[model samples]
Target chain A: MSFALNGRPGVSEATRERILRIAKEMNWRPHSAARALGGARADAVGLVVARPVETIGVEPFFGQLLAGLQAELSAKSIALHLMVVEDTAAEIEVYRRWVSEHRVDAFVVVDLQVKDPRIAVLEELQVPSLILGGPGRHGGLTSVWADDRKAMLSVVEYLAALGHRRIAHLAGMPAFHHTARRMRALRDHAKRLELIDAVSIPTDYSDAQGAAATRTLLARSPRPTAIIYDSDVMAVAGLAVAAEMGVSVPDELSIVSFEDSVLTRIVHPPITALVRDTFALARQAARSVLAAIEDPGSARDLETATPILTVRGSTSPPPGDAIHETV
Target chain B: MSFALNGRPGVSEATRERILRIAKEMNWRPHSAARALGGARADAVGLVVARPVETIGVEPFFGQLLAGLQAELSAKSIALHLMVVEDTAAEIEVYRRWVSEHRVDAFVVVDLQVKDPRIAVLEELQVPSLILGGPGRHGGLTSVWADDRKAMLSVVEYLAALGHRRIAHLAGMPAFHHTARRMRALRDHAKRLELIDAVSIPTDYSDAQGAAATRTLLARSPRPTAIIYDSDVMAVAGLAVAAEMGVSVPDELSIVSFEDSVLTRIVHPPITALVRDTFALARQAARSVLAAIEDPGSARDLETATPILTVRGSTSPPPGDAIHETV
Candidate 1:
């Protein structure tokens, strides 16, 4: 049992591999209680999503991320125990339980809110976890993330170059760490292209809100010529709203989504999107947590990939107002 | 422990409720070993998805079902442990692990293939499980399902009424139990309509495959006047392909997707889709598994809802072919 449970010097590497294969084939796993008594190492990772269960279907980002994360973990023979909690409090409670009971070796944390409450909870338990966002405030945990600021700058740069002097960013929930960071970057970049009017619209990342925001933006006397959405769902929604209002895409307006997935490509006049490998990032997050579990010293925070802006049918020279909007 | 576990008469109902709440809030789940020794009631549910993990982003159906299932499970404080396996053998292996270790009280199963191997595995283990499709070839497992055959018939009937005689069903992988059922029904309904050309094209539930299928169907000398896709992604892809092929939607071709979600509604010329409440169906599946867990005798297979067709911009009288092929 000891030979199988831990990678130790006593067992030959080949023998250990054989033992693991046989054990796996026989469906042998250390019982939770027995493993607890045997001391730590649940041989699994846990992720408790604090978002409401309703959000899972509306957002492909979560599904894509988990697919990548799960693939990496499963390849390492690491089981992912996922839980859906209603809010942060429920999430913290699950965290405390998993930590106290040693139900998981480490955790893959996501949905980073500003001054996230779960951070302190995980810190108190001293469990090794890897956050899937930038290290905000303080850190007991390492992280893997894309350069959101750079990505935001590029989106603004692309729109500005397309003669879009008045651009609006349909931002995700205003309070998230990444959302705030991206919004700041948008403002900073917009300022660099002076006389450019970039208004940030705070949104809850829903299709309804996205459509409502679309109506609000387009109804303005001097409506923004281009709009960048924080999600594909919102972008797709905005596109539908544009069509409903008789606004010809790229002729009357331009639509760009922050994340590229199936939705972006499947839409008519495929959206110009900032494409990132969410799957690879998820895999990296999984690997980071495992590394933290096995050898804490070797684990380091990572910035996985640089998101690239792809111009599909969404961007064009701003409709008749690019030069006129300049101060 | 017995009072809380068994809900025996010794404990007051209020006290039982309070005890359960506290235990859950405390994340103080009874250890699986202790539960095994005590006999029955693991207080958790398992769902093992047997598909390539990469497909999660491309498919919205999985996320929608999980969201609904998770909500129902979370309400009862029943932990949901999800696993992803590549094939039947891996899925069976997961079942064995969960069964032997009492890791889950019951399971929610999806993706029922023809002559499914999981049924044999589940029957041998006698673990309480609820399949997520119609009760087709009869197995020990109970299921909660929407009326898929009726849904298919209605799609063909609507298209026929729209003056589309050369209609094709863009079928999901034909090996799936539901796909075969829907295809058979589509053929039967079309024959009743006396259409000269009514065919089913198999697809792998990916946008690329959907587009390729669409191209192949359209390139034929006498192309399908209308097409019904297996998924929203496929329908959306078919719509894009139609645009690229210079065939106007609902004019040169009418399009319908079998499963409806945000994707169907968001696209330009919004797809005429058979809208089933997948979320509610999933909740029913979750409840079915839970009921089976609490009392095996009380659980029975259920037929839940009938899917309804919603006509949108994508379906209309076929352009020139509308008059030619009618009986």
Candidate 2:
């Protein structure tokens, strides 16, 4: 009749048995056990998002991904702890505390940079983590990434088919490992196509930065006829700048962007860009993280999201007048 | 020399003293001792967003608020754990687990509904939480909200000033606390202005839902000349529906929306909508949550944001040919 079991004092056996039986019957075993297990020793998943919140609003990709992760975690009742750090160093400190204190069962690492310090720390601590956006330098950790290289190639091929010879890129930070991969893919695509003077200007993925970068590229001696941006916000900004400068899009210049946010579709001349289902990416990352938590060996699995091109109004063949003028 | 402490069988006093001295110099205190001395806990501040991820993408408000929260939390080395719950009941469960297990120090609650169940749970647990868009039901918990009533009134007055009498509103769920407050305010404003036939349709805040509602209103014997929506996405959907029906914007109908996201500016003939600096709202929420965590008494302090109207190309006077042609 007593609630005590295995020398642990609590409620009556009937109540405890009823609760345990109900939990098992309802498939609430993982979360209930996790909650009963207590902290620094419980089974909760953690996510360390290193990007600032301001950046997240401007960039639609992460918001979608986070949503996907939330959807996956909520169903399993496995808690997803999100920490927003100022920089990579702070992220490392967060991971260190979470791992050493045994506060989290696994980690979801995002925005991996070239020569990331987190890789070493994660490896040394032997903590399980799923990296979203792979750091090509790391071979040991499990990674879930969008195929940026293939996406970039697709973008180039699509633009070339439209006869855009002078294409410029407004890329994200050069220091980012994925940025480097994307840039390499872009250059190779342009080279193979025998295009002259394929240019890339690196910006920090802000609309203003994108606009400013676009302005710089436009001011060149032989102005680029087409511009590509890493994010839709940047592309939107570039569009605004082009509008303000009296440049008619798809007539004087064409524009393409990534992310395919609401902005892309709503803009006057909808941007032709590569689109990835952010929710799918998030779900993938969340599932991968859960799998890693369930079996640490799952950390060896690599998942890549293929980007699809959505053609809208912003792209067209070079203007006949402009082509004749250039000739 | 060992690293032992007072009466503890560990390391020597000399080694311990050196560690303590270095810690003191660096202002780095042990978490356990710091907890006793009222130092910052490593626990994160969690946000349980009750809305779905698909909804988050279309709504710009949450993104801005999260960014603001992130900015504030990052400065204090506190993390923000975000979980998306399917419904209010699920949200309560998430909160319970987070509080009982000390997963987070506090929470920021969003999308408050009338007679919300979370209020009772929060009260029972006495957990520190700040609700965005307050229900006006919970007096004890801290609430940070925009002046929805005033915002609704302002939009009504703005449309009224443009000489539009029949105005329809595409609103969020009627059960939502903000929706009730906004509806009441809109109705009161209409009565005060002596405007006839002001109507409102409650929806789930989705583009498809908004479009369907807009279609119903447009089919009325006397269609509304000015339509105001609770969200930009809804407004965008309404615009699309109008376009499909060959209704010219600002010529036959004027549309105004809430929450000026990038969608507002990018759409053709930019939407004239209610604008608030989401960044500021986010910053304030983050700051308020941290303050509440530090001093639970601060929960009584209510911070309200004022909504500003951004006039774009969507609003104008009623067409001159309508009444005459109908007659």
Candidate 2 chain B worst ten-residue window by lDDT: B25-34
Most accurate candidate by lDDT: 1
Q: Estimate each model's TM-score.
A: 0.89, 0.84
Candidate lDDT scores, in order, read: 0.80, 0.74
Please write out the lDDT profile of model 1 over residues B138-229, one tens digit for every residue: 38688887777888888888787877888888898888989998988977776788787888888889899999999999899888889999
As for candidate 1, its interface RMSD to one decimal place is 8.2
Tell me each candidate's RMSD, in Å, in order: 7.7, 8.0
Tens-place lDDT digits, model 1, residues A241-325: 9999998898889899998988988888899999998988888888788788877655466877778999999777776755566
DockQ of 2: 0.25
Q: Who wins the TM-score comparison?
A: 1
Q: In candidate 2, list every pair of residues with a backbone clash.
A: B2-B11, B2-B12, B3-B11, B3-B12, B4-B11, B4-B12, B68-B282, B68-B283
Candidate 2, superposed: residue stretches over 4 Å from native: A1-41, A216-222, A322-327, B1-42, B215-222, B240-246, B322-327
Instruction: Name the top DockQ candidate.
Output: 1
Give per-residue lDDT, candidate 2, residue B90: 81
Residue B267, candidate 2: alpha-carbon lDDT: 62
